[model samples]
Every structure is written in C-alpha cells, then in structure tokens.
Target: MSDAQSLWHLADGRALTLAGAAEARRLAVSRGRVWLTLSGTTDRPAEDCWLEAGEAVALAPGQTAVLEGWPAAEFELLVPPCSAAPGRGGLLGRRLFGG
Candidate 1:
C-alpha cells in the first residue's frame, strides 16, 4: 500500500472495506461503476454514493469506507507522494473516508 497507486478489481456483488486510514487518499473508478459508503465523523454525517467510470473521491484521515462493485469494476487507490512518514500509519492507521 506504500506505492503511489494501487489497482484493484472487484467482482459483482463483492465488497472492499478500507479502515483505519492514516493519511488522505483518493479512490478512482477506472472501469464500470461502484457503490461507496463512508463512515461519519464528529463534524459530518455519514454518506452513501455511486461512482461511475472516471469518477473519483477523496478520503480523509481517520475515516473508513466500504465499496462494492456494480457488476464488476476496476479502480485505483492513490496517495500523495509527500504524505508518507516514518512511524505513521501505512494506509491503515487513523482514517477518514469520503468527499
């Protein structure tokens, strides 16, 4: 998960959950569509969304997300090159999801 970007494929009806995120990241759809659910924080309400191909969402620190493919999908999870740090969570620490 340390790479700048990682590609993942989700089968129809399959789901992926990203939790305990330590840094900000982006999830972009490369092919097909996805359904996304983001956990709420003290400052904001929880959200549910649908993303089509070429769409993207920003995930905040200390949040979590649940994603499901709509008839199969390909996507990428990306992190900024400057965001990684020593002793910090490597993509699975404090997490913020959605936006």
Candidate 2:
C-alpha cells in the first residue's frame, strides 16, 4: 500500500483553492464539515458538494475547486498524491503540499 498524505486544513468559513488533474481528486474529511464548489468550464457547469465528518468527496480534474469549512475541518487528498515529479497545473509541489 502507498503511504498516506495530507492536503490542507480549514477553519470556520476558510477556503482553499486547489488544482486537480485528469483523474478525480479524492478528498477525505477528518473532522467537522466542508463544502466544495467546483468551478465551471466552457464544457461543464459548476457544481456543489458537501461532506461531513467521516465523509469524503471526489472532484474531477482539469479545473480548480474551492473547499470551505463549516466550522472546522481537516482533510486529506487521496488521488494524485504528492510526487517527486511536478505534475500539470503547478510546480511548487513541495511548497504547496509538503515534502
């Protein structure tokens, strides 16, 4: 099995802007609740998804998604886990995710 990874954290009303790849991004909440807004593209419309404690959500790649906390929340991104090689979208992997 691959090792686990951490994505980002949020406090009440806080939000994080993230980029996803062609593969869906797997987001798992560790505490509290979170809401997601998937941005629309020329091909697709926007969408919203909600997740509570112990719940998770998957987001399609190729665009940015917004993650906001209900009150307080901790989450981990499953897909496209941190990699040594920089992927599409950004190159500041270590700066954004961690080493």
lDDT for 40 (candidate 2): 82
Q: Candidate 2, residue 78: CA error in Å? A: 1.0
The lowest-lDDT stretch of 10 consecutive residues in candidate 2 is: 81-90
Listed in order, each prediction's TM-score against the native is 0.79, 0.65
Pairs that collide, model 2: none
Residue range 24-61, candidate 2, lDDT tens digits: 56778888888888888677799898888789766666
Residue 34, model 1: lDDT of 96
What digit string (tens of lDDT, one per residue) describes model 1 on residues 47-92? Answer: 9999999999988887798999999999998887557564355444
For each candidate, how many residue pairs have backbone atoms clashing (under 3 Å)?
A: 10, 0
Pairs that collide in candidate 1 are 20-93, 21-94, 60-96, 61-95, 61-96, 62-94, 62-95, 62-96, 63-95, 63-96
Q: Give the TM-score of candidate 1.
A: 0.79
> Candidate 2: lDDT over CA atoms?
0.73
